[model samples]
Target: MRGEGSAASAAGGISGGDGGASGTVPPPRGGSRRGGSRRGGGPANRRGRRRVLRWVASVLSLLILGTGAAGYLYYRHLNGSIQTDALNLGETKLGGSKPNAFGQTPLNILIIGSDARNDAANQALGGATETFDGPPLADVQMLLHLSADRSNMSVVSMPRDTMLMMPKCTEANGTVHEASKGLVQTNESLSRGGPGCTVAAWTELTKIPIDHFMMIDFKGVVSMADAIGGVPVCVEQNVHSRTRDGKGSGLKLPAGTTNIQGEQALQWLRTRYGFEDGTDIGRTHAQHQYMNSMAREFRKNAKLTNPVKLNSLAQAAIEAMVVDPGLNKIDKLFDLSMELKKVPPGRITMTTMPWIYSTRPGLDGRVEPKAGEAEDLFRMVREDIALDGQGSGTPASAGSSPAPSASAPGTAGTAQSAPPAATAAAPAKIAVSVRNATGGKDGAQAKAKGRATEVATLLAGKGFTKAVADTQTGAEDTTVVRFATDRQAADAAALATALGLPASSVEKSGEVPGIVLYVGKDWRTGDAPPAPAPAPTKAPDSAHPLNGDNDKACMAIQPGFTW
Candidate 1:
């Protein structure tokens, strides 16, 4: 009865405005029992059966009650075991335009999984210090997009290795760091300003608004998965993981679709060396699959509807979660749950930003946007467009400027524009250059040059009177459209669209002194537009072939369960 009351309070506070207080419900009257007893055969016979049945029922009820009580107590123990206050989720304003969906405002949630282990709670949760001895980086940074229509949702993973201008951040202990102190690593940003600073950094870099953030450490993830029984995940190949240091290792799973819970789930998510590429990208894709499978499994499990399981999950989430204080209450959590419940798994899409190794001088290993690629990706999110289909824009060239348009203010050559950078008194011509960067195919160079000329011609028509395509060996795979400054970059992006180039093929080259254009394999110079993709073949009972109609159930491990 207490457990039931607790469930009612928690759910009611979320569903209604009860403030999560306990309440008492009156017991049933005695007349109903008497009437049922009278309907039985004879008074003595009824009494005997009722007595035996009551005894058996009472024992069974007690056993069930005892199990529930034990489970609840165990959850309380787990909650007490965690250090919930170690990470301070600093204040973050909801930035960017409101997202459109289901009459409910779109929400951007920054989901962070930290590698912090300096504290005792973290250490107990199997968090260990790396030999490198740097502060914990964001092991996982995913931005969840709940669309305005509530018809779709997506998770965009921002790679830790991305090279970006990190905004100044104040640490938990009131330490301040500058964004302009040279290019900084993405994960280090989290260590500096906590989640707020990370959100700030993303906002500054991409100019998209973020709504909320939720972070969970290793312990929380493991325990949550365990509580959920297990998360179903599909593995394309066999995986065996062994840590060289031996602190965290020993994961072996046969290649196929399987339900992974607890330690096994953690291993699957954390394994980096097992993949062929062994890059974070591969690991990211794996995590995406794991998340999808988990969503599926959670939906399928009937036990999840049970009060015991629901209580366990809620308690675990509350204990392990370090969410924005605004979301600390049960009502807020329930509201979020209800809103998110409307979104089906089929509408949930996932992707990583298009990136390549950072080309900034001397930063060989780090990754950066391959020109305008990241910007375009961010813009797509801002616009709430589906990244998977034709709805997605083309990738811009590395370093291409933002598109100049009536929509974008303070852009180059606009009605209220600033003039291009000054040359000598003669007003030197800013010649545009293009080279065949797509590695050797006969006539490719000439074709690229011709296309470049055509693009230059388009630019000239748009008041870039002196634009001209360069004839040179631009055989590198990278197609960069450089601009002199923010204004010029904007101008170049606008011209790119009119020139019929994919936005991805155009990029702002921070290295280039002036506006330039680069093209990649995905682009072609032509007057006529390409045909749209054919519709997917529909199933007999389905009108939309690509519609994700079938529900795929999955499970996630609860926080405390062992592998």
Candidate 2:
């Protein structure tokens, strides 16, 4: 047995009995030397030695097993540290994503950062004693999307100042938050019912099924960053974020790559005052750089296999995390991390949603989603398309035949290849549903405001007196005419003809009612739709995609913030 060696060896080699160094150590090349010891000679002494060796083995095995039991108990302790609640607290439950052709579905998790100072550690990190015990705001929100093949990942960050209609949510304590009648600040949803409410708001807006959520506070960020060792960040110039009154992120860094963690990492992520343009948009970009650099350096260090480092991450996460029911267990969390590990750093892309300053009342300082571009970004995630542009995933173009587009409204579509121009019957007495689809693509012009009603009115000027305009949005790129039944085919063609659309645009559908006129993006302001180009697969240029492997990139510092 391994423990038959010196006492020092016995203590060191007590891991297992599976042929490991700790398991067995061969006797000095052969059987114990006879007469080598003064008390040794024949079978009696040999038998005694054998008994001692067996006893040592037994003792070593017992020690190893006991240590394993302790480790198991610690694992249980870790599990108990984690808290869980519902995945979605919205009364109107959202649906899940369908599996791909290979029976693989994507995993979407929302990572939330709360500006909460409920405890001593948090108050120290956030430094707002007057605001302690107040409703927390989600200062940071990122949706992490793992592709169906686990080959790529995409992150979408929503600025805290965004304004939207938050859905109805109920807390675990049975407090019901009614849906907003007017647009509300996106970050306020966190105070309604915890991170679950935030998750509900995101799912309702993006319509992307979220599988789980993880929420952390200021203190949590510091502890987790400490466990990650350090993440390297770069600045274009030496800069400090604080003003004379000490109102800022308090970040100060030299113009170069520096491996930062703990408090410094937190500052770097929150340093909007020192970054370019000195706005929340700039802070969002800085956060992207930190996240990407951490993702890259974490794998390069290969710390996941190190037991001490692994334990540090686990302990940090457990102490400062509140997750959904699906990830309440340690083993489940490990499996999820494994899935993320399968993706290489280069395939990960992080972007902020395209946004514009809001003009809505009382929201002058806040932002709203930029109409066309924001929807395009959401479309990519909903369709499980990789944002890194290395994959060929494409959204179902909104400008398809009579069928409705699977993408969000206002997304530009291209003309579908279809039949030759057909003869039109009289346009009299035909009912048409005119819908505005001039919404997507990062175009210089915003959506045509009254395009649907304008088209409906145009149909009225023509012989089709029963045309109606609705608020329903379409993502079609080319204008099209859809008819539900065989009898309405001629009527649909007549309406298409009146709008100067080609016959290829008339499509027969089983789902549409009567006849519908989809005023696609191409026919936004014109009497006739123009010839369109192919549908775009890349995100709008405004998204500012940062790849994980881009280490040379540096944050641009503002002139006034320099030290």
Candidate 3:
């Protein structure tokens, strides 16, 4: 099939190498099939299943050791089960990355939780019961960021309901899905061109190079949870999932912690109707907590040392995922997992992308990326800087020096390059016009009460006596210090120094009088702009910082979900 050929090409493996039972390049054992054996459940069938299990267990033992001494014995069987898909359109078509000081490149993988009921097992899991096979939704999307040195890991979630532009993508069959000039729900990318299109949407939005992707379906989720034994979750109060009218997830649990597995685990992940805020954002928090616990469990379980457990997990994980060709090999996945293991859980941080509720007509309840805030995150990731201050010796935390813009190097937070007149202006003599340009897609400003006046007041306290709040607020992509003429360039430079903006951002507008300090989304709420000088050793506070190992908090049950 065309799909199989595309997948095989993606894995970078030899063509026609070890095809699997599904008529695909790499097929899984019969036991990995969704339902029981196609043949009768006789004594011979039972014996066959036992032999396969035992053979798998022996192969896993050798793999966990990493010596590859006996790899040839099971390499074909394991490799054949993997399914690969195209990773990206092209690094050139999509902007690529920047290596760290060590010359090691960072890895960014898009983890997709696909709700694709393409067969009987998936259909039984639930969603639009009328059809046997339905279009897939990339419902739970998380971008897993691994630092170049593997010192830290960060996972950032994008809400499924976020409305954004999806770039044009080509499917396996050579059919191209055109870009939506207007906004569409982020999850729609999956149905358009499989998981590859979803990766394209992220690259377009963040401009961060996506190395690869791994997609799992409804059955995959259940199988994975079972293989891991169970994961721990918590709630602040007694919660019941089902609604009064029967539109709930059918999950009910008492207050405090619970070790949930299988169907119960699926419910915990899919119970958005009765969780905190009853929204996807709340569900994202729950997922982070679950992932953190799962990591801890893996560390504690020592599955690699136990042949049975290791084989079970390895088999389940392989059967559950469709990954990029680069990661299609058993050794490749093992190596990646080892790299991830190097980072301690305490160094891992999980956060949701900054976004605002949408008010666009017919798009109510959806969200759009919060412009300046989201870019700050994307820049950090692209530059290979750690959000938690634990990556390499160079920390990209709150107070770290901001990266210089690609267009203008050595302009970030440096005062030596400022214009002469900028040094001559006294603090009290610096007249500034503070404009609040933190408005929305429409003309509506953020409901932040008197934000312009507040910022101007802050400037006044800093000795800019003439700093007055502008009556009009507009939408701006980047914060800037603009001057009306070239004569005022020095003054703009001085103001940029005060606001920690790069000198490249200062420009002569030939319109606004004095220094027009257009406050973008970056400093919308802060009392003062980030200082240009070296930040204190202490880390800067992030918007929604989630510490993986240290957090033990439970979900606060919503009013409706409470029993």
Candidate 2, position 8, lDDT: 31
Q: Pick the candidate with the highest TM-score.
A: 2
Backbone collision tally, model 2: 6
Put down candidate 1 lDDT per residue, 1-563, tens digits, no spaces: 11112343222211121010012211111111111211112231111111101111111111222223324443434433333222222222223334122112456766776655555554544412231244555546777766554456666777666766676555657677655557666766666757677777776666556666666654334345565576566544554432222211234555566766654555555544343344455556666666665555545654344566655555545554566655544434444554455566676666676677655575655677555555555666666765444242232244764322211111211322222432322112445655444443223543344666665566677555677676654533434455656455445555555555444344433346565555443345554224323322211111111222232322222111122
TM-score of 1: 0.53
RMSD of 1: 20.8
Query: How would you encode candidate 2's per-residue C-alpha lDDT over 294-389 as one tens digit per residue?
Result: 767656664345455445545655566677888777656555655566578799888899988777554545678898789788878877788877
Alpha-carbon deviation at 137 in model 3, angstroms: 1.9
Clashes of 1: 51
Pairs in clash, predicted candidate 2: 398-476, 399-476, 410-439, 410-440, 411-440, 413-477
Candidate 3: clashing pairs of residues? 10-325, 11-325, 20-27, 26-80, 27-80
Q: Where's the lowest-lDDT run of ten residues in candidate 2?
A: 14-23
| Ten residues in sequence with the least summed lDDT for candidate 3 | 48-57
lDDT of 3 by residue, 1-563 (tens): 11111332212111111111222111111211112321233321212111111111221222232322233234435777888888754211232334443344567878887656576655544424433445666766778788765678777778777788777887778787877878888877887878888888887677677776777654444444565577788989987654443334445678999997655655565555456665556666776777677667765675345455445555555665678877777766655555565677787887788888777776655677886677677666666667777555442455654432211111211222212232437767878887877663344556355777988887787677888998866655456677775556676677777666765456544347667888776566786655433322212243365776854768877675576
